[model samples]
Target: MVAQYPGMWSGRDDGATLWGKLAHDRFRYMAGIYKVHNWIDGGSGSGHNPLFAGRIEYNFLDPEPSPAYYTASTYYGKAHILAIGLAGQYQVNGVGSALQKGDYKAWNVDGLFEKRIGTKARYDVYTLEAAYYQYRTDGVCDIASSFNNHKADYGNIGGINSGTAILVSTAYLIPWRVGWGRIQPLLRYQQFRFAHHLYGPGNPKTRQFDAGANYVMDGHNLRFTFDFARYTPASGTQSDAFLLGMQMQY
Candidate 1:
């Protein structure tokens, strides 16, 4: 089981320090029809790899297109979440690392349906969703000398959680818009029962919360936002609390 050397490998900088998506809060909120997208491109200035060099990119386009390469666009029909987007990928040759898997062109789609409970009039703020797929592209099925490393969890079957589910979720949104801006709070409860080592044994269910304020400008159709989050799990393992960060949309 020894490869002679042990070191952590990295491909893309999707997120490391940030608190990540506050599923407790809607990443975006609007009543009417709209189109949206977001992108974040960053790299490490430190941590030179023991054998490989770190990344320096000219644009959001990286030599390794990993999970960080995502497109967020939504299409809603009568207060429902209908959007489809997938992250494609490009792998470096012979390395077994997706040094630049930019979104799978084979499975690539813009986004998919994201639905809430009711229509905009009633402001039904709760919803649940998931996506699954499986394909063989001649990629390695072994990692750490094991095919089990590819097992799926959360109701997905086989190497792809394509048919099974290990979890169910509940969501909530409380929002208000005033003359100055808009404010919203979000919450999510995730339940996982499938017994898999992917998330570890005795994997506890999860609960998360996010709160934010948006400065809405009608003239240019701009919304500037600041948010924070605190997560307490039904089965405590990785709980967190932090001032999330920021974003702007129109």
Candidate 2:
């Protein structure tokens, strides 16, 4: 897969092309190795920065990694399941500007678990995901200042910043019938904190509470979701947001 973002120079595009293959499919243990080249070609200055990443995973209870989406049958099964993953990334010429200074890199590891209790008609669904990320930056200008300004969040905005982040989210799916679809009510909480200031002077931290429901029609391929979220930052008043969305796939 190739990830591309609109470049700061208007016409050029920043690209991170990744290639990988999944290992032997015995249904229990799986792994994949991927290499990525992140750079802005044909843009201004010297943009030859790149990053490479790899991940390995193991599943217990069931014999495979779960599907990418939660509305699939893989998640609504009658089994106690657990999956663990470890991943890392390395970067060269971390700063994408001609005035390159330092290199940036990060390591991440995560675990996911799901369990279905009782029968399909009166079952309880539980899922938990916890992840940790460690970052190392040679300097405050590690990421091109131009590039950081283009990002929408702290996670993507790189800099002379070194920090660790911990995130844990757990959601319970209660499947209740509504018309021809199944309505699954979900409750989730997430917290993220950075040891150093991610955006500026103060520590960048946020805690969010989300309540949502999904109308699963034809699984995740065709579904509707309604969610409400409240975010509490390190400072300032809490912010609230709502989302109503639909997904369609062939």
Candidate 3:
């Protein structure tokens, strides 16, 4: 077994194993395996429960060896790229419930389309990403716990609840040259929903809108971003927040 971090096996989890990607042009595929300790079903002597996951992605231009965890692009100038991906995961008696046999499953699919238009002095970059996720578990009680416990994409709501979610986001960038380097104006919109309404009457449904600007010095190596976001929840009050951040990469 292999892990991405040192001492990952020190916790309740035994170890993590990853299967590298096999790629051909625009297509890429990979898988992962891991196990968690089960103290109930006879402890370590009963063997650790297993978890499995796999992903497949296709990038239309400048292919990548594997799927990216995020759906954003920082490319400028003349370029066009579009990618689609599908991923799924399964866990056998994981995350606090040992009720019955293996009884949790999750699946998700997404697409990304990004493009840069015009020349150096005047260019526009835009990207759109959309995704959908489906979750199922053994019982209502298990589903309730999984929605709050299971950690995956789209917040803490994945892999074992009887709910559905869809997320869509779009971003646009306009860049201009400055004395120090380049300044980029970014605008983004996001919408997320739980179509099936897991908690019924008063569950949270989220929507967010953000606008930001970035200062790029050495590619993505050195950058500064300032943005404001307005968040609204269907079952709660609305809040507005702002952030100023610097990113440095060697």
Candidate achieving the largest lDDT: 3
**Regarding lDDT, does 1 or 2 come out ahead?**
2
Residue range with the least summed lDDT across 10 consecutive positions in model 2:
1-10
Question: What is the lDDT of every predicted structure here?
Answer: 0.28, 0.54, 0.55
Worst 10 residues of 1 by lDDT: 34-43
Candidate 1 global CA lDDT score: 0.28
TM-scores for all candidates: the values are: 0.32, 0.69, 0.67
Tens digits of per-residue lDDT for model 1, 1-77: 10111122222222122112213322321111111001111111112221211211111111111122232222111
Indicate the residue-level lDDT of 181 in model 1. Answer: 47
Q: Which ranges of candidate 1 are over 4 A from the true structure?
A: 1-70, 73-80, 84-176, 188-239
What lDDT does model 2 reach? 0.54
Question: What is candidate 2's lDDT per residue for 1-250, written digit by digit as tens?
Answer: 0111122332122444343324333122223222222233322223444455455566655644343211122354455667776766556555434354445566777787888777767776777777777765454334443363544332223333456666666666665556877776677666655445445566666678888877877765688989998988768579999999998988
The local lDDT score (0 to 100) that residue 79 gets in candidate 1 is 39
Tens digit per residue, CA lDDT, model 3, 1-250: 0111111222123444454434545676666665542323422213344666677777787654223433345554334768788987666554333444334566778887777777767777776767777655444323221233433322212223344566666666655667666776766655444434444654445667778778767756688889998888766688998999998977
Which ranges of candidate 2 are over 4 A from the true structure?
A: 1-38, 41-49, 65-74, 120-122, 142-162, 195-202, 234-237
